[model samples]
Target: MAEQLTGLAGDRVLLGRTSTAERVSDILRSRISEGYFPPGTRLSEDSIGGALGVSRNTLREAFRLLTHERLLIHELNRGVFVRVLTVEDVEDIYRTRSLVECAVVRGLGEPPYPLQGLAAAVAEGERAAVDSDWKALGTANIHFHRELVALAGSERTDELMRSVFAELRLAFHVVDDPRRLHEPYLTRNRELLHTLQAGDRRGAERLLDTYLADSLERVVEVYRRRVGEDGTGAS
Candidate 1:
């Protein structure tokens, strides 16, 4: 952990002029989303604070914020660790995504649609696939969904979904086979993108809704098998 932090040392602090806690939280959030802080990894205050050149108090505040967002959990005596999401969490996340993403596609704005973001994200996934970068492909998949939600033209909703995607990354980190989990989605995402690009709005909504449902089922099956009913990962 200290070595990891050392690499981040001397980097510009995020969101300049923000409060210390907020800035620390943003960096930590980005790290977690990037899969640097994998699920169940213990975060030592001394190590993290020393690495980031911040005080323990500030680090604790940042941890508290992430915990509130369900990205980390503090045990009574063992200290804070990245949260290990259960199968139930996966189901709920997909449910929320299905509702919100499907809604965005259904009510997408009229012609001259704001699709540059979506197109960029799709292109990113394609490049990742060409390089066989499974982890990056997964990240690009999340970006596509984020842009899809942006179609609704709601900053508040986009912010909410951002947190949702971060939590979703936790599940991704625990995946036993990255290719098995993300490869199929690469093609599906491209197909979905084309549907919208061709102005098949209705077809796009149905595809997205079905896509979320199928994804939820696949993730739940794999997750349950990997983690078991009580959330203790298979040993």
Candidate 2:
């Protein structure tokens, strides 16, 4: 954990002069989304504070903020740990994603709707796949969806999906077969990008809707197997 925190020292400089709790939460949230702190892992205030050069109070406030985001849970005596999502939580996340992402595509006003971000995400996934880095591939997958949501051009929606995608990563972390989970989507993402690039908004929406539905089933299938009915896995 300390070693992982070491790499994040550069993020402190990114925060500029003062290290507010909001800035700390942003760093921690990004770490959690990137799989640095997987679900069910305990967060250490002492170690994280020393690493980030923040006060314990500030760290606790950051923890509190993340807890409100549903990415972390605090137990009476057990300290704070990353939240382990349930099957219902996964389903709900997909439902929310389908509604927002597809709507973003449907409302895209015109042809050639901002393809730069989506194109970049697809390329990122391709590079990860070529390297056989399934974990990085998964991160790229989320990036693809994030870029999709960005097409909406609404900061409120962006903020909402930011936490949703981070929570989605919690489910992805528990899947036993990362390749089986993430490999299939690379082509679909590329296809969707191409469809949008060609000015086929309806076609792109159809692809995205199917993509989210298929992905929900894939993740939930593995999620149930690994996490069990109680929502608690080996961790």
Candidate 3:
């Protein structure tokens, strides 16, 4: 099967009429998530295109798309580099995640919405963490929240969280240890599920808010330390 993207566009079936820009954007996004193009790393149009086996035009298009997302930033007279998110950016992301996600869980109470999917996602996160699969864990965590937002009963809401989740994946690049960053939250997630199962929607919402803030701080702390070492990184 072909790969997928979690955006307004969703999973794209590669077909006869797929645009080069879209394909290249998808490929480049995957590479960035896989720890290829890290923060502050410049992209040369021709070079990356040649390496990825795409044309320069396609690569440029991909770069522009990512730039629009704030994942990539352009410098005048220079090339594009992947963004190193600031603590402010981290807080902003958390704020948005909390707003969208907590609101999602607030509406879900006991025995109503099927939470089996979220439970499975939590398990997948743990298994992925144990396997030293940070990438998979990251994806699972995003899926968990994305599904949480799905409870808001709106596709538009789901799409909004999906974009944030994608940027969250990109932010994971600078993380030193995925286990330290995410594994501890598995229990809290389980507990929150139990609370929701018990019809404690308010408690679940509070737990989710705390979880988002704490998790955001953990990663931001790591990001800050790294940026300190480099001196020109995340502010």
Candidate 4:
């Protein structure tokens, strides 16, 4: 963990003079989403604060913000840890995603929508696949959806889904088979992109709806098997 904090020294520099709890939260949030701090991992305040060159108060504030976002949880006398989501939590996340993401596609006024971000994400997933890097492939998958939500041009919705996407990554970390979890989506993402590129918003929405539904089932199945009825992942 200390070594990981050491590597984040450069990330703190990006904060510059405007350092605040929100900025610290952004860095920690990005790290959590990227699996640098995986599910069930404890975040050491001393190491993180020292590495980021921030005060304990600032780091605690950042942790408080993340806890509010459901990305982390504070245990009594146990410090703060990345959240380990339960099966129900996974279901609720997909429910929210279906509501928000499908609406984003449905609300697009017309086709020929800006698709460069989606295209780039698809390309990134393909590169990761070619290299047989399944974890990177999953990250690309999340990026594709993030780009999808951005099409709405609503910062509020973007902010909402940003937390959702990060929470979704917690579930991803517990899956035993990244290939099974992410492989099928590679093609589906391309198909959805093609549908939008061809000016078929209706088709795109249908593709996304099915995509989310299927993904929800896949993830929940993994969660049940790995987490069981305990609501916590196996050690």
**How high is the CA lDDT of each candidate model?**
0.87, 0.91, 0.75, 0.92
Q: How do the predictions measure up, each by TM-score?
A: 0.89, 0.89, 0.79, 0.90
3 or 4: which has the higher TM-score?
A: 4
Better of 1 and 4 by lDDT: 4
lDDT of 1 by residue, 1-235 (tens): 9988877774545433237987898899989999999988999999999999988778888999889889999999999999888888888889889888998888876655778888898899889989999999999999999999999989989988988999999989878888888889878888888888888888999998888888888788878888765457963
Q: Give a tens-digit lDDT track for model 2, residues 1-235.
A: 8988998986786465345888999999999988899888999999999999988888898999899999999999989999999889999999999999999999998786888998899999999999999999999999999999999999999999999998998899888899999999999999999999899999999999989999999998898788975578632
Clashes of 3: 0
lDDT by residue for model 4 (197-219), tens: 99999888899999999999999
Per-residue lDDT of 105-157 in model 3, one digit per residue for the tens? 77664555677878888988889977988667777777777767877779888
The predicted structure with the larger lDDT, 3 or 4, is: 4
**Error of model 4, residue 71, in angstroms:** 0.7
TM-score of 2: 0.89
- Collision pairs in model 4: none
User: In model 3, what are the clashing residue pairs, if there are any?
Assistant: none
RMSD of each: 8.4, 8.5, 7.6, 8.5
Kindly report which residue stretches of model 2 are placed more than 4 angstroms away from their true locations once superposed: 1-19
Off by over 4 Å in 3: 1-19, 51-53, 228-231
Cα lDDT, model 4, residue 5? 92
Give candidate 1 misplaced runs (Cα > 4 Å). 1-18
Q: What TM-score number comes out for model 4? A: 0.90
* Shift of residue 100 alpha carbon in model 3, Å: 1.0
